[model samples]
Structure formats: C-alpha cells, structure tokens
Target chain A: MSDPGTITDSGSSGEAPVTMLATPIRLDYQYTAGLSQSRFLQGIAQGKFIGQRCPACHKVYVPPRGSCPTDGVATTDPVELSNSGTVTTYCVVNVPFQGQSIEIPYICAQILLDGANIAFMGLIQELPATDVRMGMRVEAVWLPKDQWGLTMASVKYFRPNGEPDADYETFKEYL
Target chain B: MADSEVLRAPHVLEYPYVRSVGPVIGAFLTGLRDGRILGAQSRDAQGKATVIVPPTEYDPVTSADVGALVEVGQSGVVTTWSWAPEPKKDQPLDRPFAWVLVRLDGATTAMLHVVDAGSLDAMSSGMRVTARWRPAAERVGRVQDIECFVPEAANP
Candidate 1:
C-alpha cells in the first residue's frame, strides 16, 4: 500500500463534526512484591498473616516495608500474626467516587492485627458505619481457597469478631 | 529468598478523565478540523507577539494568559528530533518515524509531531517537512487530524 499518511479527497464530508472526546486510559503493570511483602502476600494466599519483627525494637510489622521506621533497622524475623485485630481508628464514607464497587455508607478503618506495630487500612463491614468505633475488634473474612492469589484480595473484608470492644488507651497512641 | 520464589500479580491502573479544552486550544483544534493550522498569539519576555502551535493557556516564558489565534503554515522546519525505531501503539505512525519539534513558518515556538521520512537516512535536523493531513471527511477536531508530516523535498 502507498503512504497511509496522505490527504486524499475521497470520502464526502456530510455529517457534523465531533468536537469533544472522553479519553479513558488504562495502564498495565507487573508489580513484583519484593521478598518481605512477597512472603506476606504468598502467606495470605494460604490463609496466613506473615509479619516481620524488628530486631532493634522487637515490634512486629504486618506486611513489612523491609525496615523499621522507628529504629531504622532491618526487620529479619518473620512473625505469624493473628488474623483478628482492633480497629485503631476509622472513618465512615458517604460520598460516592469513581471506580467505587462497594455500596455507599461503608466504614473504612485502620486495623492493628494482634502483635503487629503498624496498622493497615481495611474495610470494616457486617455492621453499621456508625457502629464502627475506635478499639472495635474485627476478624478477617477469607475468600474461597481456590480464588486465593499473591494479593491481599484473599481476605474479602473484616467483620466484628464477637469480642468486646478493646480499651481505647491500648491503641490510641498508634493512631 | 530466591527471586523466583516471590509471587507476582498483574496490576492495572485506570484513569478516566473528561476535561474541556478551553477557548485557546479549542480555536487551534477547530482550525485543524477545518483544514487549517492555527497558533496562539502570546508575547515573550521582550513583549513581542510570539505564536505557539497547539497553543498553551499561559505564555510559556511569562505565564500570562489570553491570545488571539493566528494562522500558521502547514510546512515547517524540524528543529530537533529523536528516531522512533519501533513505534508503539497509539503513536501517530505505525512504521518507523522521527518524533520531531517542528517550528512552522510564522510561528515562534515549535510543536511536537512525527515525521515519516521512510527511513533514518532521510531524517535530519533543519529538514523541511509538510503536514500530510487525513482526508476531509475523516478530519476530527483532534491532533491526529494531521496524520503525519513528510519530508517536503520528496513529497513536492
């Protein structure tokens, strides 16, 4: 074929021209969760919470970021933490947003898994958004084993574990 | 742990944006839609009217807004460019082309576009090129309205 980039006076200009275009972009990434988080993600696929313990402060971190933020030391020891934890703090989302799959008025909270120093953000469900409060105990609701992968998607969401509300003083400093 | 022992997952990030191209750019694209090339009339630090193609909202040097759209030539000089040996998806051309900054006649600033010179041997700085537009019917008010620029000497 000849050069495609050519001004050929062929087709008739009949219809009114388009003035606006809505551009949607999708970017694909092959995210390699490094050794520490890789072990954490791989562990979650098997229904386990693999955390790392800081050698200096002895504080365990869930989904370790390779080093201790406080001590500035490497976290070497892998500690298996409880799937259940206390909600350190939380916020009730009422405003809708793009790519929002969950229904409105849901509770998103910082969950401090037992024996882990750092709290991770998680969705707290199976209870009213207003009812989710500080120091509330919650447990992971794991998806089917066959659907598990090297991702946090293994745990669907957190629900009240039927335990009494934890004392606020125990988790207030971590907030 | 060994590198292969680590597991991986495919991660996708999507951003959907609907933004209005304001008057300055709207005029330029509208010109493209009607088979004309227009540049924005802005002033430089010296206060002389500088015409910029694919116009900017603010004066690039002074960052002041507001400009009258002025017509620029379809033919331009390639100021500088890099060769795209293997063009990726969504590029102006599928075949080998050079991503160029072409300074059109009657315009002070250069607009980035591509030059289809057939091969690297045909591409060079200061090479004269002309816009090879799409047929009138296919002219959308988008940058792709000008399909790609070709070397002026050969095409002429």
Candidate 2:
C-alpha cells in the first residue's frame, strides 16, 4: 500500500502552511445543591442516611432527588435508610486514570441499599478482590466524626458485613 | 425553605485537546505574543474595505479569504458593556468589572474583553479604553496575553 500520510496531502498544493498552538483553558464553577440533595448531604454529615420516596410510586431513592425518574412526579417523602446494603454487581479496577484516589486492583461495586429502590456505586474494601461476590452483604465503614463534613467522603468505603450473602431473589430486579 | 442553608460544591470543566490556529489566527496570536494587535483586512458586502480584530481566516459577511494582516491601534471605544458584580472563576478579572465589546480605532468589528473600571457607575458606552498587556515573562501566544483593558486615562 502507498504511504498513509501521502494519501491525505492531495489538497495541500493551494493552501498556506498551518501551525498548531497548545493552550490550557481552565474554568471553575460552584454548583448549588437544591433542596432534595441538600437534605441528603446534611443527613450524611450527621451520620444519618436519608432517602426520598416518590409520592405516587413509593419507590425509595437514596441520594434523594427532587423528582422521581419512573413516575415523573415529585418525591416529597423523606425516608431514613440503613447503612447496610447488598452488593448487586462489581468490577475489578486495574487500569489507572488521572485524579483516581484508590489503588489498583480494587473492587468498585454497585450497592443496593436497604429500603431504597436504586443502587449507587462505591469502592469496596476490607476484603480480598477475589472474594468480592455479586450478592455480598456490606455496610458503610465511616471515617471519624472529626473528619466528616458535607461530603459522602465521610464513609471511607464499604466493607463486607458478617451477615450471610443476600439471596438472589432479594436483588434480582435491581440488576 | 428560606431558613435552610444551601449546599455548594465546586466543579471544574476541562477540554484536553490541542488545536491548530491556522495561518490567519496564528498570525494574530503571534502579534499578541510580541506585544502588538493585528486585524484582518476584508471587504464588506458593499465591497468597501474593513478590518476585523481577533482576525478570522474568511470574511464573516462575504465568506471570502481575508486579504491581508494589518496592525491596529491599542486604544478603542467601548461600544457596549454589562456589569459583572461578582466575577466568576477563570474570567479575565477577579473583582467587579465590566464585560465590554470594544471597537478598536482601525477595526470595523468589535472584540470582547473585560474592563477593570472600579464600579458600574464608572463605565459607559463611548468610553476610551486601552489594552493592558500581561508582564513580558507571562506573555503567551494567546488572546489572554492581554490581561484586560483599562480606561485610557487610568492607564496613563
């Protein structure tokens, strides 16, 4: 085959030479968390887990949102959620990326919290990577209260609780 | 609730890519690096000569290749402005300033930049303003090389 670079140069005869410049454009923004999410974060800071329930469908949502995705109605009911949950699915992370805080070969799992309809992702720790299973029971291992603030970072990571693996029937719909 | 505190968080958006400025825009940025401003020479629909700042490779109205590069005056007239009471992050100025559209002395079209007038009452259309270049060491081949614009009298 002819050289790949020469095939793309057919239009260069009439055009002027071009030069590329590199520049870094940095922008920062402050986002205001609205009513529903603000309440959830405040609860996390106080070592309490809060979720909102959809008024029509009654689906409990952790990390509460203003409106329900399923019924498209306002989620006005606030519900307290247990810190313990079942690991519905997980992935073994071996690849590296910029701004990644965790070490390689860690398990990132989707946790279906008790009393909530939706699942959220978090780092799974305090267990061997190979031992992490699809139906493992886990609980939020929180950081010291002095280190807590308005962030979910207060929960360092989720660890496997001594409870037995949740039955497949319990989290089948969540997958 | 009015009494409830609003929660805030920081977000950063970044584009990690390298771009080619092409011949016309490359020339303009090079001029900025050397402490000068260049405009593109073009013809309007009426075939009259015009110059545009932050030069474009093709004329915006006529869609024809710009004819030549011309050096333009540093001072200009503020054609319009809006007050930014609380400047957002990464804007040209950190303090309260005016976002202005200025028509340089020799250019027909306007360019956008911030003016560091102390207060909103100090800014108005038809005000004379001059480009304020960043220090020589901080000069990069980019539009931001000119840190901001200041009132002509304030610069002197």
Candidate 3:
C-alpha cells in the first residue's frame, strides 16, 4: 500500500545486496528447408559469401540457401559473392545487453554485399563509432587465416573503403 | 514477385520445465502436501535461527549446511515490501497488490508473497499475517498452494 520503491529496511547494515531473480524463459524452435545456413556458415569461415540461384526464377540468393523463395523449389548451383558492399541502414548500439561483446557504442549495420540481391547483417569497424552512415562503401575485416570457422562472425566488422559514399537514392532500396 | 502472396508464420514455441528440488525441499513439500509449514536451522558460523519453506539446502548468506527440515508455525512478520498498482501477468493477484517479504516465525530471512490487505495503510512491516492455503482439491506441488497471506489475530 505504501510507496512501492520505499526502502522499508532503512537501517539495514550489511554488504549491499543484489537480488538476482532467476527469471525462466522457454523457447522451442523449428526449422524449414531452404538454403542450408550451415553450409553458408562454412563459407563465411573460409572468408566467402555463398548464394544460390533459383533455376526456375533466376534470382540469386546470398549465403547460398537451400531453395528459392519465389519458385518454392530447391536451388541447383551455389555462387560465391564479392566481399565489397554498400552500407544500407544501421544503428549504433550505445547500450549493452547481457553476454554482449565489443563493449557498448558499436556500429551494427545492414550491408548489401556485392553480387547478392539481399543484404546481410554485420558490424562496422575501424571508423569511429560516430562516423558510420548509410550508403557508405565498406569492406569486410576477415579473421586471422588460421582461426576462420563456419560462422559469419569471421568477417568481424566492415570499415570505410575510402571511396565516395554512395548517394542515399543509390542504396535506399537495399534498406 | 509483386503478385506473390506473403504467408507470414511464427518461428518459436514453448515446453514444460521440470525442476528437481534437493532432499530438504523435497521433505518440506511432502509436509506441505499433507498440510504443514516447514523450516530449517541455520548452521552458519553465526548459527542464526532461520525458518524457510521448501526447506533450503544451505544458509542464505553463507553456504553452510543447514539442519534437517522441521515443521514451523504458519504465522509470519512482514519485513520489506513493494506495491504493484497494476499487477503484471502471472502475478498472484489480478488486481492492485503489495508484494511483501514476510519473515515467517522462526525464519531469519524473508520470502516474497502477496499480501491481501485492503490498502497500504492497512499493511506495515512487523504486521502479523497467516497463510491462506488453496482449496484442498486444487493443491499442487508448487508455491501457489500457499496462496496469499491475510491479517491474523495478535500473537497469544
């Protein structure tokens, strides 16, 4: 009934206590057949982007998928993508969440990796956290040659390519 | 692609969680199912007297071994509390409420539970309250069985 935030035990004398509630959250996930994310993940480990071409629809998918969204059928040949891409939309993560890396105030952006129809999710690096922007031409930062794995995180973050930033209209559709 | 129909779908689901409580808590629950309150003796260097339901495996402050579980009285004293003007989902009460940490008789630390008193003024630290158990037919192996606490007559 009284003020909810009032400290009733005002005279409490002891080490400041931090109440950690074990909040329980349950999640069950199911996967659908498309481009095998695992194989694409393997490609990223080797410092490459793989995409699949739908034989029926002729659309090229990035991170080579198992099937095409438009044709509703499995893709045949897998294609490797170029590392260069233009920045689309992005946010500067000034706030940190539990179990996060790279500290706070990092740039997470949508990158339209070259030779792919869809943009990929990645981080932007090298540039000051304040200098990131849309339409900036950025390139991938690969991991050490020996430490690559089957994960996109191998690319680390993209840094400014030092080229003229693309106009907003050029990369607007990628967002 | 313009004429393509978008069939949206959800991606995640849920499952039941089964918790395995240790011996002390196991015996305490056995007592509750048969209508009883339980507590454990603190075995820390301080050797403080503390009562805990679902008898804890170790002391709250120190990890010292607590004594065997024993039945304690159903009454308690409120310690600290917070009021929820608008209760959240799955809380004990559907209406406004006060979440109080009640130090049950013989317990050193407190346990959180809802207080069904009329208003804030009607509730205070050191107020005496008693357990209100769920209906006999609905009792399950869970904390909800204890329901909330209500004001009780002064200690005899």
The TM-score measured for candidate 3 stands at: 0.47
Candidate 1 chain A TM is: 0.88
Q: What DockQ results do all the predictions give, each relative to the true complex?
A: 0.26, 0.25, 0.07
User: What are the per-residue Cα lDDT tens digits for candidate 2 across B1-156?
Assistant: 443587888988886667988667776766776677778888899999999897887898989887777778999999999999999877888899999999999999999988999999889999999999998668767788889899999999
- What clash count goes with each model? 0, 0, 6
| Segments in model 3 whose C-alpha atoms lie over 4 Å from true places | A1-35, B1-156
**Clashing pairs in model 2, backbone N/Cα/C closer than 3 A:** none
Error of 1 at B129 (Å): 2.4
lDDT at A142, model 1: 90
Top lDDT prediction, candidate number: 2
TM-score of model 3, chain A?
Answer: 0.75
**Candidate 2 TM-score for chain A:** 0.86
Candidate 3 lDDT at B74 equals: 76
lDDT of 2 by residue, A17-119 (tens): 3356776666688988888889889889998789999988899998887899989998978999998999999999989998798888899999999999989
Provide the TM-score for each candidate, comma-separated.
0.80, 0.68, 0.47
**DockQ-better candidate, 1 vs 3:** 1
Superposed model 1: Cα runs more than 4 Å off: A1-29, B39-73, B86-89, B103-110
Positional deviation of residue A161's Cα in model 2 after best superposition, in angstroms: 3.2
Q: What's the distance in Å from true for residue A110, model 3?
A: 0.5
lDDT of 1 by residue, A1-175 (tens): 1211121112213333334656779898998778899888878889999999999989999888779999998887999999899999988999999779999899999999998888999999999888988999999999998998777888999999999999988888789
